[model samples]
Target: KSFLSKIESYNITGKQWVGSESWITQAELASDERKNILQGAIGFALPQASIPGLREFLLSLKPSDEPQSDVIKAFWEKFFDCSFSPSNTSTMCNGTEDLRTVSSDYTDVTYFRAENNVYKAVYLVAYALHALLQCRNGSNPITGKSCVTRNEVRPDLVLEYIKYVNFTTQNGAKVFFDENGDSVAQYDLVNWQMKEDGSVEIVNIGQYDTSVPEGEKFKLKENTEIVWGGNSIQVPRSVCREPCPPGSRKAINKRKPVCCFDCFECPEGTISNQTSPECFVCPPEFWPNEKKDQCFPKPTEYLSYKEIMGALLTGFGCVGIFLSLLTSIIFLTHKETPIVKANNSELSFLLLFSLKLCFLCSLTFIGRPSEWSCMLRHTAFGITFVLCISCVLGKTIVVLMAFRATLPGSNVMKWFGPAQQRLSVLTFTLIQVVICIFWLTINPPFPKMNMKYYKEKIILECALGSAVGFWAVLGYIGLLAFLCFILAFLARKLPDSFNEAKLITFSMLIFCAVWITFIPAYVSSPGKFTVAVEIFAILASSFGLLACIFFPKCYIIIFRPEQNSKKHLMGKIPP
Candidate 1:
């Protein structure tokens, strides 16, 4: 009833039948026509008689010669005609030949001899004979008669024979026991395969030899040899649910076995990489691929000069260089003019050179990062810009002191003369150079591969080893520009005929604006774009300085030559 209930639950509808008494003849058993009726169902019978008929009946249901169908057929064939029994008609024991012959008188009943009956009875008789021989004596010494004494017939003698019984059976089975008197467990792995005649036959796929080591015990043939149950080609599933594959983990079901569980995706930065119960983190310098099943080398990334953003920034740097060169030439050609001479042309020249250096330095930010380039690029940029701003500062101070000295009997002009202008420029530049030296000596920048910011790519960038040193460089330059801007603003209306302070103020304004906007953008930008933004700021500020201060002066020197002369601007001093 329980079997019927289970089959019904599984929707396995089939005809049901029963077997006769155990002692029934083959003809009597075959009398029931229902025994031959094939169906997808279960059967319950002893391993001795029913196996052969059951095998044939099940095979009749499967007309097709599929590998799995053959496997099912082989299972029954192996079960009925097993090597474990001594009465098996086959002339083989395991894989070895059986040479011993059975007596002809018992030939008809010999076929019914199972291992549980005939083989065990043979061992029992052999042990009894051994014990009897050991106990037998011609006569007892004290009794003086031919008799077997009870002292001679001992349990130890029989036990010794049974424990050490190592012999080959008539069926050619080499049987023995271990130290614990337990038989060696061995099993044959069988598979069903289709014969050439369109019939099913049994195949010895492999074996489990317990006498071998544990790892070498179970040996199965190639996967192609084994045909699983049912008509399907895949291996039969025993668990309640399918397994959790790679890149995922299992969530155990409280109501079922551990084999029955739900699968879940692994967490970020980790992977299972195979069917596993838990996930683990990938190694350093490696990242999970798209499937999260395995780790791979992280892809390197940087602002390459070949990319559009990099090319645009580089082109702008080139343009700045061209303009700076042109400006330097224009000033040098009109070096004797009063307007150019009065504005400290030497300082102007150095400032323009520094601007050129700034433009070129920005190019370093747009290429594959190297150790030397990373260290040199930022330090060089900071020092050069400081020099540029220093020149602007010197000019502002000279303009302020020159006008103040002309108004009264002041000796400020001598103190703030051309020589002092050169000294101040040198002193300011040397201070920046010293700061850069200290910064490099202490904790300098170096090339770094960063993986934390992005998941898929490695940002190949320059790491500022010390944040304080970096900010200090920027802060010092900012201070100098602020001072220059303030001084120039105060002296913007001071004798405009010979004053360059108005132009200096506007240039400083542009420079300050560029840097102020750069901070937030640099902070917000991700990956290589951050480098691009910094380069853009550098070019923008350098161009502002060049255009604001020099462009107007060049316009007047080249286009309006009369305005460049001293007589046109006789306002206060002896021009």
Candidate 2:
């Protein structure tokens, strides 16, 4: 009581105070002024049990009762402040508060009973005496003769017997002391709850029994509500720092306790939980959320017709197809014109058809890649380009052969006539068809999810199952294009009224330049930009071939009809 009063004087009552068993007992007896300071404190006390007939024995006490000691009579007079005798009934203690009536000082009957340890000590001594004086047959166990008298009993002998005492009480409680002469540890968790009348009540909230196994020793009652310090119902925070939340880790402070730390957020692409000390890296197919608390599946990406780039490429492909068809229409309308008939008009029509196929093949590369589309995009690109190059090669050879036919006894025209031109185109295009077949049969292109390109998204692209097969297909197309460029370059100086070889040479130059630059650009492009680069290359090269080869013929046929006559074609009207 004096220590608590000193703590309260220091204004330190806000903190919880854990006290011994005597602390609560004195708090119950102390005045309200001295006890109210401990209203929200918690303490441990010896567990109390009901003593049989104890309440009735305390209530029946009287000063005039027979066989009452002088101590009992004197204590009764001091308690009631009056004397009592059987002879003088008028002066006897009456109308006064007794043990039967509840008062401010006496609340419950169990508190008045002897402490549990006292009963266990008395039983220990009784059991020890029983063993010490017990006789076996006609001799005592201690003396090995007649039963030993009380005079022969020694304090050391009694102490030795008390060390081994083990017995159970009538209340079914086991009583035994350890080697250190201390009983098993057991205590009741008590909380000092303040009532509305400004009185403190010690509530038994839980128990701690050392006799039980480890981890099972401390237990709280389910129905009891603990009263925290400052009469607050909520538990108070006692640590120096709060715990770190999810999506963050703890950084311990320098020269400080473990509880004191700072919270740092997890890095990108990783996540952390509330209890984990380190961040976890998300899997390749997953990405961390904004808060870094969890992982989610990554978004898939592909070149789609809905995006701006894909739409613009699609539109350009359509324009290329329209221009090719327009050129074809002009040639068909002016089929017998001198300019159309001068150049091999049959190969011109075939070349325009192949250019149209080249434009249409680029559309297949725009949508989400699939098994069939992946196979079709590369194969169609290779074969259509081969066909288109073969047509240009045929035209170049025809220009050279026409000039050779005019020479003295030159039979080149018959050897490389229209039949042979068609056979050459068929042979060159068929080689590409065979290569495509072998590529598909051996190791075809297939769709795959590319995860390494980006951390937060999946790139849906075509995987070249066999790098050798993909490169071979591209190499064959390059070979045909190079051959056409070489042939057209040699025949570019051939004399003719409408020299188509010069136009073929210029078109092949543009084709070679575009594809040559496309190699490095295609290899270096990333994500969906790779597909866009290939599409741009296709459109640029196809436009180059179409504009250089056919736009001049269409212009002269439509706007310069007089220059398209047979006299101009035979070079008679050129001067």
Candidate 3:
């Protein structure tokens, strides 16, 4: 006992490795700094040590025999020997927290995730930690001193201990909380202010219990109780009418707090920004009036070449096709293109519908998108696409037929003629019509209701019919395009401009390229991009057709008077 007592005094009297014992002249006590450190360490360790499955730890030391080796030996010994030295090694247990449904016993409750709000999480953490701090204190076995976690709102009590809060900013006082049950911190954080209904969340701050048993990191749940006020304030969410996005004024009762304060508007000419933020505005060269917030094109170079010309060309083009078909029928004993009179009858139907295709393409420029106008536009675009491709296919078959007829015993002659051309056009058209019918039967293009749309009165709309229609349309177009490609390749060595066939082949190739590129471009964008896509499509494809089929007509009709013959429209074929 005497021999052991000699070393025990040395352990207490500053002979220990950490030098913490230096001021302990008395056998029973430690200095204030040492006491403070021990108090803090005790604050941390005592809670863990008392955990039912946790093994206890103790400080250990390494001893040396030589006096010269004391400094070197103490350095190595402290590094190696300083540890809790748990007694149990073999037994292992895992602890997982179990959450019980919080009782609605108290009035203090934040709204749950009905709206994806997180205010409840902050308060729950505050309440839980409140209970935990109380559950700790003198209840602990390690700290002999008495401590208390009361209901009092001390700086350290409710707010400071919270994990998600930003205590530094005035508005940051109690702005954030972990709403979901899962908080990485040992204690969850939250904000509670008297004035706020829901919490405005503070983000990017840290938590105390963020580490796991394995020392891995845990994610903080997204639902955190956040409040608005004090050092930091959040911008109030703005809800505005579309089209009248950022600049244009709402005519009558602007749906808002007051005079255009929360009115749904866009600047006169700008469109809504493509990526983020939900608002309305007109883009450059676009204008809207205060009375209706109707988006209209602003006068610019686009005026002569764009919206006006587009509307005029489209309107006149359909009319011209209808008129030409009428005139052709009048000349051919009251009906049909010459191809229909002979074995080439199928080509007549192709020609007729090709005229229809041009007419339909013109209808796309009817007016700004509304329920009725939008439907008309889609109908026009749909018919135009289907018929245009089918006509190209019909032309290709006719060219192939001309070559096949010269070869003896070739049944390709029987496979196609005027009747076959008629059959192909009628069949392809019926397929297209069926696609339209299916679309109309299912979810036909209609006005899509949006709560955030223009003044909540006008519905933002796009074609929302059967996906099958889109697929069918693309398939029909693609098949014809492939056939056109094959025809072009077959006719590669043929003399240019011998007949209109070369012009038709080149036109078909251009049309195929335009529609093929359109597939992905349309699919990748939102419905709002429909008008933009269609405008570009019409200009590209329609122009290709016009250049191939009508440029010579225009040149002759305008410049060469002798070439303009009434017999061109009224020529009677051999009876």
Candidate 4:
């Protein structure tokens, strides 16, 4: 106050230089340097010196000091009252537009206050800059240590600027993002430097690029190239993924990863991953689709040629037996080999039975599996097998006995007289019958369709229960007949008239040869040709019977009419 009082001492109409002399003289008179600070502090209370309504606010900071600081008389600017200022419009204070908006009464005074106002206008900015940057504070644009001039603005003012300063990019600048924090596109490196006048200049020497030593375009690393017009990116030279294994499938649109490719597998019943672009399933009738990847059961309709051949061969064997029976009967009737032989005529009966049995084998192919014939077919086949074997056994025993009788000093011939011969035949016949009954009782065959699989319809087949059973019977008969031929060969040494053995011997040989050859031929031939086996065998056996027995008798009866005597015709001899 003393210094301030002295400053007013010399000033009335003229402003004097009271700062140097008065401050010095006054500070010499004072005990502390507090006078200057106290005087300045109190200066905020003066009228016309105070900031608009700011005087009231500063006064409120020291209610008791109002009398000493002379703050009660401080002028209040109505515009600074905020209540009188337009709402939301005081924001224009940063620019000169607010003055233009002022009422006309204030226009005349603008020029008077303009110069001083300008100094005060930039004072806070400079103070903020200087304070923040630790530089000298002033109203000049150059007064601050750089950071683009700092000492010009106080720290508090800098803070205010930070809050209020709006930033916008100049034309040459652009915004970019570098995820790797490496290079900026075509932009030069910049560094801050303080000018002697306290302004900051960012010196741009040259463009920055680690891609080349100097002045070169950047080349990106692989997998680093952007895609889709900068919408995305991709890794280069990735490997593809393989498909799923067998018996599996993939869902639609299930995406594979970058390093993997999509693949699908066929399902359990359905084969997949075929020869084409996608997997395929096997059709119902055809097994193993295009994939050739899996196996499945084909329909019965697709049976192989061999299967069909087996069926036809079976059919032929049946027809042969039928014809054989007819021929045997014809021979018996013409030769007068009476069916009603008083005692056991089992040999005659077995031959007849064998022929009948063979006929029944053909019935197995009557139709597909049907209820009426179901059980009968198996029984018929079994019986047929027994009968054929029985026939061969009977013939064997007949040949053996005949030869024994012809042998010198061998009495087995008389022991097995006519009745004994018949009994021996019956023995084998009954034995075979018993065997068949036993076989059927132990293991019955069924033709019930297995719906799980397709229904198998037999087009051609043996009348036998099964092919194996049929062959088993043939094997037995063959072994027996082979032994019969050996016996007959020895028996042929006897007188031709007494033995008459060549007929049976040759017939048996022919029969054996036919069946044996038929088996192989049937196996090799297609099913369509299997019928030949039956027809040919029938014709051979029939002709053999006609030649062996009937033809000889017919020759005698026709050529030697007298030879058809009472004994030859009716009583005894084979005419």
Tens digits of per-residue lDDT for model 2 on 1-575?
56657766876655666777776644454445544456667877887665556568767765446444887666565566566665453345553447665443333566532466677778889888776777788676765757656788877777777766788777655777787887777778888877766567778898888777999899999978898877778888888888777788789989898889988999889888766767889888999889888889999999999999999999999999999999999999999987888888899999999999999999999999999999999999989999999998999888888888899988889999889999999999999899899989999999999998898999999998888887887888888888888988998877667788889889989999998999999999998999999999999999999999999889899999888998888888973
Cα lDDT tens digits for candidate 3, 317-362? 6556665465335334422322223213334344555755655555
Poorly placed runs, candidate 3 (over 4 Å): 1-353, 368-376, 409-411, 449-459, 495-501, 520-529, 549-575
| Alpha-carbon shift of residue 170 in model 3 (angstroms) | 64
Residues 1-575, candidate 4, lDDT per residue (tens digit)?
66445544653221111122112222233222222222211000000112243333433442233434433222222333332224564332211123334354333332212233343435535534543554334333343434434334445555543333222222222222244433233323222222344333332322434334554643233332222111122322323544555545544454655446455555434665434444566654445544446656653321122465545654555665655565555545545432223112455555566555555554443344444354455455445544554454555556566556657887785676667756755665565556556545555344442323332222232223445644554565566567666766666665433234565677667767776787878666543244345445544553453355334544554466455454443336653
List lDDT for all candidates, in order. 0.71, 0.83, 0.46, 0.44
Candidate 1 C-alpha lDDT tens digits along 1-575: 35434544565422332222232212222212222221211222111211123334433433133435655344433533433335556422342211122223222232332333355446655854453454235743333445445566666655655655666544444456788878655544444333334344334456666667879977766764554443234555456787778888889989888777899988877788555558888877788877778988888999998888888888999999999999999999889998788788898999999999999899888899898998898888988998899899998998899889878678888888889888888888888888888889999999998888998779999998888888888888998999999999999998757568999999999999999999999889988989988998899999999998999889889888878877655464353
Worst 10 residues of 1 by lDDT: 38-47
- The TM-scores of all predictions, comma-separated, are 0.72, 0.77, 0.38, 0.38
Give me the overall lDDT of model 3. 0.46
Best candidate (score: TM-score) = 2
